[model samples]
Target: MSSGSFIMSILDEAPTLAQPRSTPKHEFKGHKSNIWSFVFLHDNVHIVSGSEDGMMCKWDCDTGLLVGEPWESEGGSINALALSPDGKTISCGRYNGSVEMWNTDGEMSEDILTGHTTWVSALSWSPSGAHIASGSNDGIILIQKAGNGEVEPEVGLMKMRQLEGRVMCLAYSHLGDRIASGAYNKTICILDNNTGKLLVGPIEDLGGLMKSVVWSLDDSKLYSASDKFARVFDSTEGTELYRFEHESFIYSVALSPKHNVLACVGEDGVAQLWDTESHEPLGQLFHQEDRKLLRCMSFSRDGQYLAYGGDHENITLWVLRVIAPELLVRAFMIILQVEKPYSRTLHPCLHHSPASRQVLSP
Candidate 1:
């Protein structure tokens, strides 16, 4: 099937449900400074986070506990973190303008990719696990070969592209052939991964600094989050598709790999979920006070949960639940104390049914 046709089919199957609410399940806290970036490990049972405290640490998802000794970044604070597609290594971008990789198994140094002249703000691993892409405040994007600790800075890193503003975020397309990067200049650039050539943009003039960018699972659309908006654009043509407005500056956006939901968090401290196909708001999960800005968000590979961290030191985990219409109505009724038998029988299908009786039971 053609790529466009395949993407359409995927979008048609994307789930559509009423706005759902999320409940926080776990809170992992330990970082001494703001947690800037994080990514889920391949197993979904662990997560690694980078912090302004100049440390990167792993945590157990199930227990909400630290997994190993924190890796110290002696040069400066860590600004970005990404896991290799094979799940074998973790890469971190530091304020000192260096990218460091560590083996997940032994937590030992794997490689250090250095070339950026300013803080490395973004990092993405190609879906094939063969390359690591990084962006820096120096306004350059670098693609480096993923390897053991043998790569020398002089020969290992290749300059991919240079932009007019700081590269704030980077994401590899699902096909592993293209990359989408957001920059402080309020634009998005699409590049060919293999040849490091521009394919679509400097898609110009977004209203604010582009904080995050993500590609759809089918690689048909690119989504970006910036000040007060999350937008979808045609991945191939670079045409604007939809714009989702927010109450405040948006800090991060994530697309679920297992579901059709797109999640975003912002300065409002509310994590909003939207339907990918319709571009409609789904539901919202509130984090700290509205004054606190949420900086990062990530979805699990299975799409079962979402994790976000921000101005606060603790990381919050939320479970995603898809509720049936009947159950949803019943839950609303119970919460409202609508206990009368007549009220319970309002739905003709539920009249005198065992489910109705169960719902009405004290």
Candidate 2:
């Protein structure tokens, strides 16, 4: 569609390679510090990014334009941010080990989640958004109940669990039930959010710090990238599927809406695409720099755009190709992008919806 775009930044956008990754069609700028985290929300129109800049910015994903002035969190470089599923609230992690919640619709701090001894590096919310999970450099994952109308933090819906190392990346299943977390210790821990028990992992495959984790759209399985390659696994069986190796350190990986595609962005400054079914490595997607590290990435809610964030602090959002439903169902309801608009659970392409409670792998 549109031509490449630009955003005047704190640091000038560097010259990119002569090849295809060209210029970011859109660029969102504001973070004063390194931005290693970002998440999409609101029909994919908005993006919330946290940075060492001591602020979290909510911006227009389409134009890389600020929705309003960046919100001041004051806790210091906010490297972790998660938007509630309902799009009503926002959760941010600060450098000094504190997690705070903001009413995104209202733009105010309504809940404060505290407990870690180090900076909170990753955070997530249950599908229902009734439960909030935050992990920190302290090597602990704090589970908190979203404050029920200003109720005391104790009575609020929350819980806490311990992990082996600095918790870095977190993802909930499509159904919003199970949470798979990646940590600095190179382990991916799959937990039952309701039971609050370690269901799996220290299920290690991530060779480096697991920077990003995500499940298929239906939440049956998971895929994670640890700076080396993106690995796919059966969330139910705890089995490895495929490791899409990277040319450089892979820092972020995202699954398309149908779960048939995996896009992993590497710090080596290139992003690779893989066929989830064949487990074969496709080509790569490069960005503005020769080897500048890209910190985060996500597929748009509509599953048509692939966005990546970098150490340079600018975000690159790309519109991508689409694939229709590929499901061949067996039990309950599992929604997917069908070729036609007929509405029953379509063919199961490769979805990962974990919140359905019990998941069975084919």
Candidate 3:
């Protein structure tokens, strides 16, 4: 259709695209066991993942090549992973109740941070890259200074909080003022980042066991994933703002840094999207034929790519280009460009082939 015709149709109502099956642009495949957690490097050039195989691998995002040899975790299977805001440091929480640090250049540090009595389950880096907040199966949370390649017996330790159940997930607000944590007790807590003082809850009655939590770009709201729902709450009041229901147990939740879109993945083997402002489900659902239960999810800094893995040995990466009313302002239609196996001419229409989910064979 002509550009003039495209503009008019979009002004009325955007065309709907068919659900997309799992077609990853790249699948990094070095891990020998289930992938547990991963993080995008601050520069958005590389991705680092830790798995049940007790190994951490870094892959170049552009080329999909392993940057170097995988780094073996000293403690045990890694349960959580976090990268410093500056991308200079990597922190991994292990099953052995310990947290270790490594520079992005593949250099492991000498000092190990330890205090939790059981498995270390979650971790988040302070916005300034100076501190780290960690959660463990032992129901303890610690806010400590990040390692600088030296050990001094909790030298930079800041504060600690003991909860009633395993701490499952944590996120530092973009404003750097507070931290949010979700636990097995079905509660979400907000604490002052500096003093580690409880600012909010133990906010109870979330639909189910808390799995993941993240802060809005401005830090005014918090998004969390639980049993079968992805919830949004007011950061200061800890009040429920909205909840998006899922078809299966939701294991992970991620927010686009540059857009108002939230992505979620779970047991159904589908990745779903929701508009943060409208809280309405998007038209596309990313799925795979194997139906692996996805336990981890993350969006790149620019909101142009998404990565997820779990119950599988490889991490899948997708290129996402979203065209929507909120983003374009003048455009009424929502168009999504997900890298596919076959190339097609760029069209302005809203409908696309339903068979766009074929991944390129490795």
Q: What is the TM-score of each candidate against the true structure?
A: 0.80, 0.76, 0.82
Instruction: By lDDT, rank the candidates, best first.
Output: 3, 1, 2
Each prediction's RMSD over C-alphas, in Å, is 9.4, 10.9, 7.5
For candidate 2, the 10 contiguous residues with the lowest summed lDDT are 2-11
Clashes of each: 1, 20, 1
Over the stretch 200-230, how does candidate 2's per-residue lDDT look in tens digits?
A: 7667645687888888877877888885777
Provide the global lDDT of candidate 1 against the true structure: 0.76
lDDT tens digits by residue: candidate 1, 1-362: 75334433433332223234434778888999888898888888888888999887788889989987887757698899898888888888989888887777536474678878989999998888877888888887777777743332542343534467688899999889898988877888898877666788888888889899999878999999987889899999999989888778899999888667788898878777777766656544456753477899998887777889988877888766432223333443554464443343344333445644544465
By TM-score: ranked, best first: 3, 1, 2
What Cα-based lDDT does every candidate model obtain? 0.76, 0.67, 0.77
The numbered model that scores best in lDDT is: 3
Location of the lowest summed lDDT over 10 successive residues in candidate 1: 10-19
Model 1: residues >4 Å from true position, as ranges? Answer: 1-22, 148-162, 322-362
For residue 101, what is the lDDT in candidate 3?
Answer: 91
What lDDT score goes with residue 110 in model 2?
55
TM-score of 3: 0.82
